[model samples]
Target chain A: MLDAVIIVLRETLEASLLVSFLFVYSNHFSVNKKWMFLALVSGIAFAVLVALQLSEISDLYDGTGQEVLFITVLLALSLLIQWINFIVIMPNYLKSNQQLLKILFSSIIVLAISLEGAEIIVFFQSSLANDNHFHANLLGSILGLGIGISAGAVSYYLLNQLANTGVIICLFLLVVVSAGMASQAVSYLMQADFIESGYPVWNTNTLIDERSVIGQLLYALIGYEATPSFTQVIVYFSYVLIPSASFIYFKIFSVRKN
Target chain B: MVLSKTGSSVKAKRLFLIHLTMLVIGIFSVDASAKRLTIEIEIKNHFFIPDKIEIPANTKIKLIVHNRDSSSEEFESYELNREKLIMGERKANIFIGPLAAGEYPFFGEFNQKTAQGWIIVK
Candidate 1:
């Protein structure tokens, strides 16, 4: 049951952080909350489908196909959001483009949160179905959900303050988080040998083990890996660079043109 | 100088693309071979027996995780990005890399503290 709490907490906190970030952003942009709520509903519905088809999905592509699908979807969504943010949102931010941006960004959040939520639900259901610790597991999960949601609320408040001071900081955080997810997606592919992963550049296990409390938080936040391969490092940096560069270019050069 | 530079750069780009394509094919062929490499791992008392495993670089290997514990366990690895929930007293078959030489870490998600191991590819 303790283990159940720990696992649920980890997955829940990740999804919660994404939700809170979206919430704050939408509030600032004056977008209707209804659209976001609808996205959440749709995402949950999709997750149910994923959970139901888990076995079939797991069996595809010599048993590595599920990871392939996950990585592809995450990478695609990250790229799509980043591309849209640069090409559409940044330039038109001061103007009232809230409606379109609201829908676009909300869908991105839905994709991330729903996939994460699906995994948690699947984990919970499996554990419940197999084990006799029904009471303990249920209690643990409730506690985990409470803690995770509170953490998200706190972070949202702090980040909202930061946004008030400077929107660029928020933008940087958003882009960095997206890049981190992309790097993680690449690591999944590497684990399955869907992509080439070179030798480890270094191991920081002694200094900061990824299994530690702080390490897990950092992993969720910034995609920190204690031992990263050369390919992962390259992917991480390129993911961070390409979108950020586009942002800077559009911010500076496009504004100049205006 | 500009013409030669552009020509060389274009050639380099094409060469890199060719290498990437070959890498993809190499991985596919490695998977298709009839020779199946199998490794057995046992989980007892929330610990992985023979925690450190080594396999040849660039080959598909099958891993059989036998969980002796009466409680459920999830074989999870951030490095390997593979997670499987094996019900207590059950077993799971996990297929891993034709990988580049590196160390990959995995743990039992239900018992992370006691159940840790590594896969070393050489």
Candidate 2:
């Protein structure tokens, strides 16, 4: 139940952030109200279509196909997220008090619908798979989404007050969280066999079983595996390390040069 | 520097038309190519089949997932923003992007041991 809530919250929060960004952008740009409404409707419709399609497609395959499908979706999502980070989020983070409202509106329709929509659909499927009640999952998802959106909006407003100091901190935190999420996603795919050669690097399950509460929390936050395979360990370390190293390099060298 | 005002206005009009045409074409192509790619996924006795996949760039895929086991499973990928719930002996479909070349991974939220897969776009 708790896990379900977290899943829902995370998914919904992303969607809410997109929507909030759109709202602010539209208002700042003074875009025609009709066009803004059209964009919102389009985004919602697109999300529904994607969600329906996912459920329908999941019905088609039996074993290997299913695994492949899951991996494919995860990879696609990860890429999309990276794109957003590079294109939208990062730009906003780097600038100081420069309202990116115009840029935000440019791709708001597509980005808002696709990313958030997909997240919600995935959360529902995962919760249901975990033996959760349908009603409970639905409720949790809606609640989480609400909270997430509220948090994002509030945070955005707060950052405006604290200026660059708050913005930089939040941006850094977001990067770390996103990296963690990316690693976990990759690990899950490796375990699924949709990817090849993911052997355990070492079997630490004997030392600390992942079934415990602490183990589960570690798994949730840091992509911890008690008996991590060779591929899993390599992927996790590379995912975190490569990005962190790049970030450090950019901070120490690139920024200083500028 | 020597151009007449009428000639310059005509040139401007032509440029605007070209820009408009390009925008229209871009929108049309994106819409036309949004077709979903279908992939078949399996679950048996509570395990995922194949467990990993590599997708090339610019392919939109639809996953057809079937659950043969008595228990339900969820195929989830945060990166792809995709998830599908399969009840025991039931099937479902999840449509994912015209993904660029990269890696996106997923798994079964419930039967973690059995359901796992990856989208590798090259």
Maximum-TM-score candidate: 1
TM-score of 2: 0.48
Q: Give me the iRMSD of candidate 1, please.
A: 4.2
Q: Write the per-residue lDDT of candidate 2 for residues A1-258, one digit (tens) a residue.
A: 444566666555554554444444334334444554566677667766666565455434443344455455445444443343343233335344233333434345554555466556655665565453667777767776677767668855765455555544444443444444455455545433334323334656566656565654444334456644455456556555655565576667656777
**Model 1 interface DockQ:** 0.22
Report lDDT (Cα) of residue A126, candidate 1.
55
Docking class of 1: incorrect
Model 1 regions lying over 4 Å from their true place: A87-89, A93-99, A130-132, A254-258, B1-36, B42-60, B66-73, B78-105, B111-122
Candidate 2 regions off by >4 Å? Answer: A1-7, A14-43, A59-139, A197-258, B1-84, B87-122
Residues B34-77 of candidate 1 have per-residue lDDT tens digits of: 35589999999779998999999887777988878766577998
lDDT for position B40 in model 1: 95
- Candidate 1's displacement at residue B36, Å, is 6.5
Report how closely model 2 matches the true complex, as a DockQ value: 0.05
Clashes of each: 1, 57
